[model samples]
Every structure is written in C-alpha cells, then in structure tokens.
Target: MADQTFDIEYVANLARLSLSDEEKQQLGSQLGQILDYIDQLNEVDVEGVEATAHPFPLVNVMRDDVIEGSLPHNEAMQNAPKKLNGLFQVPKIVE
Candidate 1:
C-alpha cells in the first residue's frame, strides 16, 4: 500500500481547514493509526470467502404504498396565521 502515509497539511489545505500545529500533528497520528489498521486487515487470508455488499442477507422492510384520504382544504388551513382567498399568504421571498 506504499506505506499509506498521510500529509496533514496537504489534506487540511484540500479541505480548506485551518488547523494549529498541535492539531495537525494529532490528526496526522490518528489518521496514520487508522490506515495501519486497514493495512493489517489487508494481510488476512480470505481464501474461499465470498464477496458481498452486506455481511448478512437483507430484505425490504417497507410497506406497500396505498392511496390515502386527505384533509379538506378549509380544515387544513384552519391553523394558518394568515390566509388569502382560501390559501396561505406569506411575505415576498424574492425580488
């Protein structure tokens, strides 16, 4: 993995972040450790292991969509702070 080295300053510049020297050093070490763990995982044997998007089987848990009743316009507009001509009114938003 070509040593998986990280450049904290370069990454911060790319992200448009301004970090103190201490913060840069700390984040660099932390990210380095995370990359080392990933490298270690790459060394494990995976012979005969099947590749999968998910570790376990998944199923759609959503219920089927169905037509539903809607509230009457007058009833739905009852709580409006302002209404004009059977519709809600608001301040102008754009020029």
Candidate 2:
C-alpha cells in the first residue's frame, strides 16, 4: 500500500469534478482514510468461507405471465395531455 497521499487534482480530474483548494485537501484526507480502512480489511482471515455474490439466499418469486384483462383504447387515451389521430401527441424530441 502506498503511504503517500493521493493526488487530489488527479482524482478530481478523473471524476470530472471541479473542487476548490480547501475541498481538494479535505477530500484527499478522507479518501486516504478510506483507502487505509480497506488496507486493514486485508488482515482479516477468511479461510474456509465461501465467496458469495449475495449475503442472503435469493429466489425467483416472479409469478407466471398471464393475460388477465384489457382496457378500451379510448379509455386509455382519456388521460393523455394531447392526442392526434387517435394517438398520444408528444412534444417533438428531434430537431
């Protein structure tokens, strides 16, 4: 692990963030502490423990796909702010 403090300007540039000198110093110190904590975690022993993607058991509880009911087109169109030719008229997105 590198003991030297991380370059704040380099980190900020990588993140595309504009930080003041004060903010850069503060964030640099905070990031150093976080890196230190991660380094400490390397000391822990995890022998015999299986690496899992998730901490809890996951199961697919999704219900089977089924068609229950249908709504009339006019009824669905009633809530549209604007409509034209029996279809919703949205603002022009492309130039």
Candidate 3:
C-alpha cells in the first residue's frame, strides 16, 4: 500500500555492503512485500487482548545450596604449572 520503492543503494551504503544491481532489485522487492504484510497486520482488531511477555509460564527451578568437601592448599596446587610461597605464580597482567 505504502510507496514500495525504498532507497536500496542508500541502505546498502549505510550497512557497508556492496550489492549488485540484481541483488539490490531483489532486496527492494522483498522489503516492499514485508512492509505490505506489516500494513495488513495494522488492520487487525484486538481491543481487549492482554500483552504477554512470554508465550510459556516461567518457574525458578533452583536447588538449595549445600556445602561440599574442601581440598587442602597443597593438594589444590599439586597439578599447577607454577607455584611460589603457597600460591599459584601466574604471569603479571598489569605493569
């Protein structure tokens, strides 16, 4: 219904895309059809319909926290690539 010829070249330039003449023509037609579909949807009557955030109901299926066995410092550092003074020695990130 609306003016079908959208500026395909301008849109392509904005998006930093290089489109051939055929591609541009194809995209222009596709975009026009999409806009027409949206215009059609605007004619629908839904005065009392409630807006839904999600299609399905969401429930927090979380489990209660529980403590687990703790490992000793020596045992924890056993497989470490490098350790010094009871701590892992990682490469310095900040100057």
Candidate 4:
C-alpha cells in the first residue's frame, strides 16, 4: 500500500502546477492510500452479488395526475409586465 508512491511530480507537470516538497510527499501519500483502498476493494468476493447503481432499492413516490381548470386569462396576466392579445408579451430577440 504505502510501498506504492504516486507520481505526484508527473501529475503536477501535466496540470501545470508547482508544489513544495512537503506538499508533494503529502499528496503522494494520500493518493497512494486511495489506490490501496481500491486494490483492497478489488480483492472482495462478489460472485453472487447483483450489480446495481445504488445500495438501497429506489421507488418514486408520485401523486395521481388530476385534470383541473386553468386560471382565467385576465387573472393570469394581472401581474405580467407586458401583455399581447390574450398572451404574455416578451422582448423580440430575432429579426
């Protein structure tokens, strides 16, 4: 795990970054730990396990779609900044 030292210098070179010696060592160690964890996960036995996007079962709780009357044209346009013939008016953006 800790035996694998991350090529922090190479990564920094690619990212156009300048890191101090201490920072490089610290980041390299952290990256090495992450790789070690991934290696450990790779060793896990999931022969009978099902592949899933999430650990828990997901369900969408939805309400029934009911038909309803819409607001009257006058009431709907009461707070509008601009209005045309029974429609909301907007600034013209195209010729």
Candidate 5:
C-alpha cells in the first residue's frame, strides 16, 4: 500500500517556499513514506482498546504542601545584589 501521489511543488507553493529540485524530490519521497506508514497504522485492530492520553498510569509525584516559617525580610535581602529601603531592588523590567 505504498502508492505515492505526493506533489512536493504544491506543498511548497502553499507554504510560500522555493524548494530546489533536489529538496523537492527528497521531500516528496519522505512525505510519501510517512503517508504510507500512516495508512498501515490505520489498519490496526483496536476494538477493545481504550483511548489514553498517556501510555502508563499517571500519579502525582509531588510532596504534600506544608506551611513553614518564611525567611525574615532582612535575611532574605542580605544576599541580594541590590537592596534599597529594606527591600530587594531589581532592575525594572517594564518600560
């Protein structure tokens, strides 16, 4: 079922691209092979299989959120590159 009816020039034009002769030929062959593989996949039997977002069972691996004492503002700002008026001073990001 590897019947190829690909048109590389049509795709290139649609994408507003200028493909060389060699690139066009290569892309056509590659795209045809991809389509043939997809056709092969379409013939698979999955009557009892359920659609899934992931292949394996997913579980949250995060630790439980716990309230803890925060670092004091003075201590937190101690290592800052720039500090002013008891707060960390960062370069303004927005104009």
Candidate 6:
C-alpha cells in the first residue's frame, strides 16, 4: 500500500476498455479510493485464526436406513392391472 498509484491506462488496456480522458480521471480516483480501503484492512491482525472453506461445519444430512418387512407376494400382485399364473403380466417389450 506504500506509495501505490492506479495506472488507469495500463489497467484499461488489460481489461480491453476504451475510456475517455474524463472517464479515465474519474475511474482512476475511484479505484484509488477502493484500494485505500483495502490497505486499511491489511492493518488488521489475524494471528492464530484458522481459515475455513465455509462459515458453518458441514454434516451428513441423510437419515439412517430402517429395515422393514416387505409385502407378501400375493398382496403385492393383488393391485396388478394384469396377472398370469402367480406374477404380473407385463406387455411384450421386445419384438
């Protein structure tokens, strides 16, 4: 932050921007002010602080799987639209 200056023309070229003289002067002052605030932030001490990817701790949100008895074969086939022998009779899928 010591003796820093915003190179308006150079930055404009890097960003592929075409700025007028008035616009360049206005933007240069604005960029300088933004950098001044960042320079002030650099004065803060962050000793022994751990960096985190997220603000809160991530956890597995899935519920535990519960094993339960399945319906009997006769009960399962009871609601079938079509049944043959003891199983559901589905339409032919292959020619």
**TM-score for all models, in order of appearance:** 0.42, 0.44, 0.41, 0.38, 0.40, 0.44
lDDT of 1 at 10: 86
Candidate 6 lDDT for residue 85 = 97
Model 5, runs deviating above 4 Å: 1-3, 44-95
Kindly indicate the candidate among 3 and 6 with the higher TM-score: 6
Q: How many backbone clashes does candidate 6 have?
A: 0
Residues 1-95, candidate 4, lDDT per residue (tens digit)? 44576678988999999999999989888888787877876678999998998788668967789888999879988998888897888888899
Give the lowest summed-lDDT range of ten residues in model 1. Answer: 1-10
Name the lDDT of candidate 6: 0.83
As a TM-score, model 2 comes out at: 0.44
Off by over 4 Å in 3: 44-95
Give the per-residue lDDT of model 2 (tens digit) for 1-95: 84558788887899999999899888878888888878876787988879898789678868769987789889999999999988988889999
Task: Tell me the lDDT of model 3 at 15.
Answer: 99
Give the candidate number with the greatest lDDT: 3
With a 3 Å backbone cut-off (N, CA, C), the pairs that clash in candidate 2 are: none
Candidate 5 residue lDDT tens string, 45-64: 98998989878976887867
What lDDT score is found at residue 70 in candidate 1?
98
Worst 10 residues of 4 by lDDT: 1-10
- lDDT for each residue of candidate 3 in 1-95, tens digit (9 for 90 to 100): 55599788898999999999999989899999989878986687878988788899678978769887799889999999889998999999999
lDDT at residue 8 of model 4 (Cα atoms): 84
**Clash pairs for candidate 3:** none
Task: Tell me how far candidate 2 lies from the true structure as C-alpha RMSD in angstroms.
Answer: 7.6
lDDT tens digits, residue span 1-95, model 1: 62446777888999999999999888887888887777877788999988898878778878669878899999999999999999899999999
Q: Model 6, which residues run further than 4 Å from truth? A: 2-4, 47-95
Worst 10 residues of 3 by lDDT: 37-46
